[model samples]
Structure formats: structure tokens, C-alpha cells
Target: MFEELRIPTLWITKVRGENTVEPTRLAPLMQYIVDKTDKDTAVIIEGIEYLILENGFETVFKFLTNLKDNLLAKMRC
Candidate 1:
């Protein structure tokens, strides 16, 4: 569906291997996106269930909390 629309996209995965980001690296990756995003930017985070299964809910929760904090901080500025 996304491919047919010609919108640029990235698929982050651990299994099936190509174009994958390590599960452990999600936080830093999100931080990078937050740092680089412009006013028109949009981000889609897929696979939360998978991430939680891979990294544990506690770690995923912390990552999301930090990411939210960072975004909120940026928004305030």
C-alpha cells in the first residue's frame, strides 16, 4: 500500500533481516529522528508489540517515556 503511493518509507525489523534496526537501538534511532525532524515531519512507529516482546515491556516503556519527554521538550521550544 505504501509502496504504491510512492511515499518514502523505512521498515525497521529484526527478523526477515533486510533494512532492519536492532531492537536495542530504537531509542537512539528515535532520538535521531527527533533531532532531525522539521516542522512538516511525520513519524510512524510500527511494531510496538514486537518491540515489547523483543526488549521487554519495561524497557520499551522507558524508551517511549523518554521519547515522549524529548518530543515534548522540543515542542515547548
Candidate 2:
């Protein structure tokens, strides 16, 4: 569906998952968004449930908190 909109997208997945071009490491994923996104950027993150399942709620919460902080700062610009 996203592809139909012609927007550039990145897909992350676990090491054993198929059809995934990128690894699902939290840091790298956040870094990629930080590097690519701006105040006007709209992002679609599709796999929070999967992330929590794989890495637990606490870890995912921290990751999301950091990512939110970063994006919020950017939005202030």
C-alpha cells in the first residue's frame, strides 16, 4: 500500500524473517529515521507489536521514548 503512494520506504525485520531487506536492530532503525526525517516528515512505523514480542515491552518502550524525544526536538525547529 505504501509503495502505491510512491513514497520511499524501509523495511526492517528479524534475522530469520523473509522478504526483509534490513535488520531490526533498535538503534540502527532509530538512527535511520533520525537521519532521514525532518519536522515535516510523516513516518509510518508498522511493527511495534512485533518489536515488543521480540524484545519485550520495557526495551521497546525505552527505544520509543528516545525516538520520540529526538523527533520532538526536531519538530521544535
Candidate 3:
């Protein structure tokens, strides 16, 4: 699906392989993208249940909250 849309995708997984990001590292990765991209960016997260299973609801919630805050901060600039 991402290939058809021509959108680059990164896998959030514990598996050690190419184009894979661990759940713990997702926040920093997203922050980097938000910081570097000049154009509007659309982020589609598909595996909330999986992330919750791996990192609990609170952790995922904090991650999302931080991402939202970062995006908003960027927008204000």
C-alpha cells in the first residue's frame, strides 16, 4: 500500500533488519523528521495495539503526546 502511494514506510519492530525502528526509538525518529522536513508531513501509524502490547498504554500515550507537542511547536515557528 505504501509502495503504491509512493510514501516511504518504516517498520516499528524488535526485529533486527533493514528499515525497522524499535518502538522505544519511535519518538526520537519522529522528532527528527518533524525537525528536518520543510513541507507538511502526514504520519500514519497503523500499529497502536502492537505498540501498547510492547510498551504499555502510558508509554505509547506519552510518545503520542510528545509527538503532538513537537509538531505544534514546529508549526508555531
Each prediction's Cα RMSD? 3.0, 3.1, 2.3
**Clashing residue pairs in candidate 2 (N, C-alpha, C atoms within 3 angstroms):** none
User: Which regions of candidate 3 are displaced past 4 Å?
Assistant: 4-6, 32-39
Badly placed stretches (over 4 Å) of model 1 are 1-8, 15-20
Better of 1 and 3 by TM-score: 3
In candidate 2, how many Å is residue 77 off? 3.9
Model 3 pairs whose backbones collide = none
Give the C-alpha miss distance for residue 19 in model 3, angstroms.
Answer: 1.5
Which is superior by TM-score, 1 or 2? 2
Residue 5, model 3, lDDT: 79
User: On residues 1-77, what C-alpha lDDT tens digit does candidate 2 reach at each position?
Assistant: 76797665767664544334343478978887887787778878887888888778998899899999999988887
lDDT of model 2 at position 13: 67
Give per-residue CA lDDT, model 1, range 1-77, as digits (tens): 87697644546565545445677687656766687565566667788887798889998898888877887778777
lDDT of 1 at 4: 100
